[model samples]
Target: MAGTDAAPADSATTGPVDRAAWVALAGCLLGLFMQMLDTTIVNIALPDLTTDLRASTSEQLLVLSVYTLAFACTLLTAATLGGRLGRRRVFVTAILAFTVSSLLCGVSQGPVELIVFRGAQGVSAALMSAQTLALIAALFPKARHGLVFGIYGAVAGLAAMLGPVVGGVLVTSDVLGWGWRTIFFVNFPLGVIACGLAWRRLPQLREQPPPRLDLRGMALSTAGLFFLLYPLAVGREQGWPPRLWVMMGASAVLLVLFVVLERRLLARGGAPLLRMDLFGSRRFTVGLSLSLLFFSVFAAFFFTVSISAQFGLGYSPLRTGLLALPFAVGGVLGSVLSPGVVDRIGSARTLCAGALVLGAGLAWVGLTLQPISGTMSIPAVIAPLVVGGIGTGLFVAPLQTAILSDTSEANIGSASGCVPTVQQIGASIGLAVVSLFFFGQVATQAHSAVPATRAELVADLQNTAVEPLFRAPMADRFADCARNQLTSAHPDRPAPGCDGDPSAQSGMAADLIGKANGQLQEAGRAVAARSFVGAFQTTLWALAAMCAAIAVLTLALGSRPGPNKPE
Candidate 1:
């Protein structure tokens, strides 16, 4: 059922040099753009989805996590199917699936429906992702691959940057009453066009003799990834109950079984979807580790910063999205320099330098968060982000190249899918883990600092525990409190007779009313500021640890893979 049994349909490899190649490239790039953009686009739109769908915080997390889970699980199979069924066929099918699913996502009436549709989109994404690099490799001659890859990297960086912008514009706009749905609905035309172009222009290479699909391995991997991801995604929201523990246990068992299954498949002369032999190459292994760690760092950064910008700093989604532009700018600079740095300084050194810069950026972000608030200066925050952007730009392409360097050209699809899959898994884990740290910090701080006598403290704790629910209102309150409390020189000072409750003083004295209200508000604001600062500091420390670990792993990347050398 799995392997390609016959040569690819024998179409001429080269046709008249015309607009065909150009069309093909554009289509592929469009497909790539949609795929990558979807990964982050939903992030900015979560607030809208929550309001429309009446979804809980946990449900929104499922919406994001499920897509990633499905993508990660199916990637290996998708890669194999591309080779066996014909890359163009698989590519078109994927685009159509993604397009249709996206439409479903937009039309969905509830969280469950939206999540299901998103999962379908993820499946479509996996299929398309499997073939992109292979298609690119087939389209360009060997000598031109470096340039092709460079262009591809740039496209990816652009898509990532554009996601927030697209989401922000769509959500802020009133046209068609689109709101968040515009983000999903917009993909329809692009996907259809890409599918059409791919069907017509893609070259047909002779397929090799049929290879076998490892169904057992596929099942094991899927089950294992789901198991691992489910807990990471949902545990924080649900407070890691015993039932969740069972799922986590199951994931561990299944993963071990998956590894064992893969080994057995390799021993049986079956082309195990993943060549276990690849890991023997130290560079490839290290590269993968760095990929996982680096992506985890980025995931934590984006998640934390997104929440902080809106929640801590009280910025609009549009403004926050605009503020994030510097990361992309940095990425562009990094991409521009990747080739030169790789050629001159060597890929390893360039990557390490990027990591160091990223570490510094994170350290700056951590150190600079102020208890006082005047909308954290745009340039001050962007400075660190630019560092991260440049570092990521340096790291992504070369790291990928190094990881895949040792992979047999035949299994390049596998390596391509594998690397991104690992990165996404790291991302999902980081999001979940960091959320746990963030909310946990909030809860812990609330418990320790908030007073037992204040009924409001209970609400605050619950709010902190489920703070992800406070899309805007609670965040605004928190920010207002911090701003007023930090800047106010005499928050608790009463106006003349302000000491007594306004209700008690109502019949007796008008002047006491204002004073009493002011005193209570001041007290409340002080409590909130302390709690907010505690949560803020705690989350920063957690992010710092994650980033620092990534920095260490980045330092471990020994060297770049020689061109065409297996990692």
Candidate 2:
């Protein structure tokens, strides 16, 4: 029952490349651009989203995390569905579906509604993403694969780097007074254009017997991922309860079962959602491992930096988003130059060089950060960010080719689909771990700031007309209040009993009270800034270390496969 109408013989792989092929490729790339853009675009809008929706910390996390969780969970199943139902059919449908979901997300009245629509959007993205590489392969000859994938990689990298910039612009511009909603709404035109192009120009290849749907594999995979990812996403916010630990343990068991099921199904000559035999190649295994490690670090780096820049540095959304512009420029440059480098030193060395440069850039950014007041000098970090971006461009552009070098033509679709799956899973795990680490450090740093806060408060009270007896106690209260404010889950809200009123002398002069409050507020800002800067610096160091490890891992990948010979 899973099939599409047969197409003309020329529509097969041997078909000549023409304007239609290029147009179809553009359609596919547009989908890729939107999908990748959405991953990080929403991040810059989170502050506005939180204010507008009155969303809690957990709800905010869910709005961001669910899209990725849904996308990662559905990729394998969607890829198989594409093979069964017809790639062009499923792809065009998904583009329209994604557009509708984005519209729904833009119009949602509550966090819950937005979350639901985001999940829908992610599934549609998966449906479209799952078909992209396979469709590209079918469209172009093997000899042009590198060139085609380079263009693909550049679009993907550009979209990701530009996400914050685009979001910031839209949210700041507040087009039609939509504020953050414009981020989602902007997808409408792009999706419609892509759908139109794809429907008309995307070739319908000849239908083969459909592969059986791996229903059990899909269920097991989905359940296992949920159990694993859900706990990580919410564990810190919920205080790391025993239930989360139990869920993680259950996740391990479920995933083991999923693997077993996959292998057994493959042995029985059944279609497994993930082909177990892909792991048989050391090259493929190493490539996947590298993806997991690389993406884990990359995702966490962006999340931490964006939060610190906006929250800690008191930057406007536009300023925070513009901070990535240098990186984006660098990424594009690196991507553009990657193929030439690969030709000279091969893919492994190019990747190694890229990783080393990225690590150095991260370290530079960490060192450049200062705990002082006022805006951070963007110029100080521009060079480092650009270096890091270039490194990212260098690594990402060739990663697909390297990963699939050893894979057979028959398994290319399966292997390509798994790449994004691992990347998303890595991103999910990274965000969870970084959140836990960053927030813990924030709390610890806040606690450590108490002594300084108390001293500052005592000095300010010395200039006031208050009695000595009341001064020490008031200073202690102020210090404790500052600590509580910094450590709260919602730091923007006032802490309890922090009204800044002198407890002992309710009848104190109004001028004296105002002065004391002003001093204390200034001190609080200083303490908060220092704590965040310290935490952000440490997080950067950790990520830089991971990048170095990625560089080392690149050496383990097999030599880049030779160029394809003409059949």
Candidate 3:
């Protein structure tokens, strides 16, 4: 409706959005929302899951990494499969798979179960996401594609913003006594509705005749990506140059073999797994690199902000999610305006501006984080975050245009898959790198701050801690109890008195006071804030460096007016 007049000169032949087309778009949009939602929705619940599952920090990180890795690796194959078969068939199958996976994830009892289900969800997401752009292309005429894409951009940007909030709300609500399980469970109903809508509304475009599945290519690429990504994802947690390094080396070898296999496939006149020639186009190559960089930074934003709001500022998940609303508003504002900017200034200049603006926003955040207090002034955080959000919106859509502008229509699905696969991989890398950097920095800072031994530190913690130890078993055994009834764990279990006599009455009294005083003195408050803020600033600095580098590459991207501009 927004850009109806921009429809192709011949678009009227198919008429307007029409009952079927409109319905189909809505259905697809819902599916898209679900997939994108899973990407960020797990952030707020990570700490909760760590406690409930008795998971180590590294194990918790796996719950996030495996999903992205599976999603990224399968994307290219999924897109090609959709194009060779039918978008409708793939879409429907993916939705069902994703729904069942969500149910499985909700019921998971351990880290393995959760990781496996998350992988399943990622595979389904790959199938679903690849066809979205391709189907949208067929739904509208060429002239109207730009406007449709803008709508798509707005939907994606908005979904990402809402994910953390929705995750936060569900986690905070503890509905049906579900606790963190509610976050994954909420998707069950949403997924079912999406499936039903898609079945009824999506146009079953004449199914294309099936082509060869490129089995060899698929296997090689899948293995190669697994090798490359598995190490990257798990390395930071497992320690680099250890077992991760072995996997990293193996992945490099396999990726090299994959490249050789692709060459052979091309020589044999077969369709390669990835269109290797995509790199031949300067615009495609440059645009893709920038997209990866931009998303890498954007992904970091969600993780950092969520942690800062919850662990540092002591906000609940819902409140933290609410804090991110301005990001979505800014994102929408920037996305809507990007088309016009590209029309007038061209994609290159627009991207350059986005890069510089994003840098400035991150710089503002880095500098101001020092002064951020527990009172949590929404305006202070929102304004600069909004500026960064706007920068994100401005940079993404135009990059897509530049990448696809010269691609053959037949290969558009592959092109679309490339966009998201690169994004997910970049996101995985960003998270791993940032997490390692943060932990490394915190460990370093913590050690440097005091010469106390671990026992001494623990003793100091026992005597002067200020906050409740959420990690202790007593806290966990009673985790099912209501928050109001949640009593201090260690205090309930009496320790030896100062004179070495164990007595419940006097020991309990002294223990309670000590517990309160210790909780009050615990570095949970100061250390959490200092470590998080320090890591956040460092990560931002890294992102700024990445942004500037990508900006340089963006200049090499061919000059294009983008789809929205009149020829």
Tell me the number of clashing residue pairs for each predicted model: 13, 0, 12
Error of 2 at 435 (Å): 1.7
TM-score of each: 0.80, 0.91, 0.82
- CA lDDT of 352 in candidate 3? 82
Clashing pairs in 2: none
Model 3 Cα lDDT, one tens digit per residue, 239-312: 56666777678778887887787777767767776767777788788877877777777777776777666765
Cα error of candidate 3 at position 307, Å: 3.5
Top model number, TM-score: 2
Candidate 2 CA-lDDT value: 0.81
Q: What tens digits encode model 2's per-residue C-alpha lDDT throughout 1-567? A: 113233323432444677777888999999999999999999999989988988888889889888888888888888888777777888999999999999999999999999999999989999898888777766676656666777787788789889999999999999999999999999999999998778856655323677788899899888888888888778767888999999899989988998999999999988788888999887778878887887888888888878887767777889889988999999999999998888778888888898888899999998888754323568899999999999999988887767765665456657657888888888888888888788777777776666776787788888877777778876777777777877876454458867565453455544455657677677666776777877788888888898999999999885755453211
| lDDT winner, 1 or 2 | 2
RMSD of model 1 against the true structure: 8.5
Model 1 misplaced regions, further than 4 Å: 1-23, 203-207, 372-375, 443-556, 560-567
Clashes of 3: 12
Q: Is candidate 2 or candidate 3 better by lDDT?
A: 2
Q: Write the per-residue lDDT of candidate 1 for residues 175-208, one digit (tens) a residue.
A: 5897889999999999988877777677543246
